[model samples]
Target chain A: MSCRIGMDVGGTNVVTGLFDSEGRLLRRSKVRTIKLSSCELIQQLAGQCKEILAAEGVRESELEAVGIGLPGFIQSESGVVSSANLPFNDVPVATRLQQLLGVPVAVENDVKMVVYGEYLHGAGKGYSHVLGLTIGTGMASAWVSDGRLHEGAGGLAGEIGHISFPDISYMCGCGMKGCLETVASTAGIARQARDGLKAGWVGLLAERFPPEIRDELTSHDVWQAYLDGDAFAGQVFQRTANWLSRVLVPSIALLSPDVIIVGGGVAAAGDIFFDSLRSYVSASLHPLYRERLRIVPPSLGDDGGLYGSAEFALKSRKIGLRI
Target chain B: MSCRIGMDVGGTNVVTGLFDSEGRLLRRSKVRTIKLSSCELIQQLAGQCKEILAAEGVRESELEAVGIGLPGFIQSESGVVSSANLPFNDVPVATRLQQLLGVPVAVENDVKMVVYGEYLHGAGKGYSHVLGLTIGTGMASAWVSDGRLHEGAGGLAGEIGHISFPDISYMCGCGMKGCLETVASTAGIARQARDGLKAGWVGLLAERFPPEIRDELTSHDVWQAYLDGDAFAGQVFQRTANWLSRVLVPSIALLSPDVIIVGGGVAAAGDIFFDSLRSYVSASLHPLYRERLRIVPPSLGDDGGLYGSAEFALKSRKIGLRI
Candidate 1:
């Protein structure tokens, strides 16, 4: 009879879902995320939680817990520390939501949530050590060891985006030069394409978008061109895969995780991108480690984060009782 | 007197020490390690263990366990799987040692042992997460999270040496091109010195070791020349630090460990090398992560792996009991 509600608050959208103890989705809701004040965002999320619970014929008293996943720097005890994309800064999200719903609440980083969800129910299921990489507006990753998220000393583990690449000249939003995200994320891909076109590197993009509109070129366009057999577009994707292999090789060598589950907007590019990436990563890895390492797409997709939030809430509730 | 014997089996030497529960070193012994068959190596290690225990006036009945730290891929339950530097391949190290000593035996990768030793009693003491990097003849690393070694699925985690560096063309011993170790380890530094001198690049090394003996130049020679104000030597060391920083920046971003402790032969170059490395890594790290991250030297020196082996044996005994 126990049910829980999970929410994924992203830069573009906020998704909430109600699930039974067995992980069955009972009800769900979505809303466009706006640049609102901390209090406003909290109120909006709380309202949606109530709506989902009511739609599922569940009451606040009967709810087990509410878990939320948000993008940004987070301290589990204090909530959102700071988010580059979200307006929440130093907000106590879990406490605020708990007060509103009269139930236990847990707040975790969005990527970590997705990793935990995958570890428990998605691609990472059955793995002792799971590594999750999400490449979108930025490149980020999370680590799960023995079914527990391996949050480093500063609660800042898995900030893979800030890894420096001296050969790269692009500056990252994190105020660093040549960060992995500056060359590997969706934003990075588009930037690379734009720079290539501006430098007289002829390609399908150049023909499709004139010089004036080239700046508006997106990763989607680059993918389409690559699929259409444009040599330049193929180079861009190949370079991306190589850059990713550079980072992943070390990660695989260091962590030796059972499985590496890749997610996010960019990962939706599917087999075309992953087939090349898997081969590159395998070929580049140490022979001893190459045998067991598997890199695959996330099966839960966007809902992975929501499911992770629910899993987080359930696990946190169990830990709270033991305490 | 629950005494334990800890043995560190490196490519060049074997060091064995006897310690009490307080982790106090009571007796120690050392022997040169040659390229011997797995059986010969095991016999040598057992002989040294007996020598140390007898010298400490400890009887077999008084011994709690035996722990060994060796260079290779280790499956703790089964012992050495494969060692790139050592002669152990699919060798049952723990069982052999246990049979020889008639006590519980736990075997772990040498780097992992050093990390555990540092985490429990050395520079990494009081930290929740610790990362250890050893740059000797080759580069390697180990990670300790929440007081446990974060061994990846295949017990091949912490193999940072194999991370590929596309820009550099140096071939690594691991049969990979452009690995971090190809440009950052002691051998790498010596190679760089040799290559620089061969190209008619002037340095203190050229003056000290004539053209004929230039090939005999070692990393120590490079360090000495750098101290003597040789520009080529300085560049080699600078480039080495830069490569270390490149690998470290990503590791720091991903793990966010409380401390990063650098050890091994190359690290013996001392403050002249570490000072520059600390500054470069600090500057390259994200602002949020840079504040709390610490990069420091290993305090246990050569004794770290031995202490780590002792710690491992003790902990394994406790776990075995629970099971």
Candidate 2:
């Protein structure tokens, strides 16, 4: 049976999965992502791919093309020009993987892959126009307009976190201030809570929540508090939702996708985030799209990148032809 | 010679043009918008298409397709479901126009169509990433990601104006407070200057500009006064650009297009707006994308939208096309 391997390169781990033509996960594995040089990281990734194939009793020659999903920008023709959260730079990942593994490989933005995977299988299933979003340590989205990944010029489309905001209250890791990422992502949640604590606003967070919540609250904790009815915590999520809506409105007004597939750890806050966001955007959208908008949670979750890479590899290689 | 007709449906007029495959506008004509009911407007738009094609000596059978670019969200499949500016209410503009013209027709969000046009031709030419913007009585943008139109799921992708802000001094047509359209648009400039004047701030606008500019100074007049070294006028444009930047930061950060095509009556203000705004965004972009951002003027002038609508039609028809 022909199979494809998918590699999702991230800050803390490299997740690789084998998928069949049907997008079924044949097997999957992960590896630690130490602060290695880009060269070393590439070598390690190649080695890991080989090891996984061996352990699964699959021959090296049995593999098909590989697809890599990156967390940041990928220039046209050049695989990955740069990524912020990960220490990647001018890395020709696709070419390198092709040379190392002796197989064809495709490198795409991770969010795009996720959006594509979701469209083919997960939350976006049955929708022709789907939007895949991953809002965690940072916020990124992929636009699948008319059943295709919307890669902006030079493969840098769907970089939604950099959309500007109303203030310079927070600094985005992308080097800009007041990016949606600085306020609505998990990083933003922690920043907001920390700023609140520093400003002497007390909440049940001190007693009911742990160090994770007090030190750096994720979107999940904030949502939990909102569900628990803590005013400060609830307001934080509410404000974040409004901020998200602010960023979403202009995009929605302009693009008008068929479905919004929200992913990332922050999205795990579930209905707390999606519900408020849906209502806020609905009530606030142009009458052209008020009721037409559907705020959906991505079903693929954390493994979406892995799934996306596999599907992309299989589709590009055709017939799931293995190496 | 293969040809297609593009129609820009505005509240005041329905402009139509005939173009060859090279995107050359061979002929142009227009008709006043019909005040008939919503269904009648669709028919009127169809009539305009017929008139334009008939005048151009192009038989309906000779045309490949017709493209209608309107001012709102176009549900995928259900043509022209809603528009805040136009009178069409869930009007099947594509089917009606196709039936009337005896050819295939595609209807898209007018703003998206313009951006698509520019991406393929005018300002967006030679670049993979380009943002097409139009600022008039209202503001809108078409986000072209990697040569594809970005329609978010539910077909509500590029709502750039509806992005929210704090301390909203303007009311947006989208029914949202603090939307970017409320402030950065020429309408916004007029409202701000007029309201500022009402609040008793003094300036040279009282004696120099017309009702639109003097009574409610636009970015155009503000820049003129600033050129004359009026600090107050400079302040107004600066504030206006600041809001534009504020909305732009997160929006652009998320999807860092290499070029932000700023057009419209407001953008006509020239350096008075771009100079300060560019500097601000440069100082504020997230580090991830700060190095790749550029704010440039729209290459396509008044005709950009007409051309963009043609682009939408070409892509929809899936014919080997050029900008």
The candidate that achieves the highest lDDT relative to the unseen native structure: 1
The count of residue-pair clashes in candidate 2 stands at 67
Number of backbone collisions per candidate, in order?
Answer: 0, 67
Worst 10 residues of 2 chain B by lDDT: B314-323
Q: Which candidate number would show the highest DockQ if scored against the true structure? A: 1
- Identify the runs in model 1 with alpha carbons over 4 angstroms from their true place: A201-203, A321-323, B33-37, B84-87, B321-323
The alpha-carbon deviation from the true structure for residue A186 of candidate 2, after best TM-score superposition, in angstroms, is: 4.2
Cα lDDT listed for each candidate? 0.83, 0.72
- Model 2 agreement with the true structure over A1-323: per-residue lDDT tens digits: 56678888888888888776566887888888878888888888889789878877888888877888877777645564477756677777777778999987888877788878888888888877776677888787777656556665445566677765556466566555567778878878867866765676666754565555567565566667667777787667767777777667655665666778887777777776788888788766666577677888878766778887787776666643222
Query: What's the lDDT for candidate 1?
Result: 0.83
**Mind giving the per-residue lDDT tens digits that candidate 1 earns over B1-323?**
88898888888899998999788988888899887888888888888888887888788788888888888878765664578778877877888878887888888888889888989889999998899999887788899888788777877788887877667898877788888888888989998888888888865788987778977889999999988889888788777877888668778877888999998877888776787788788877778787996888899888898899997898888888211
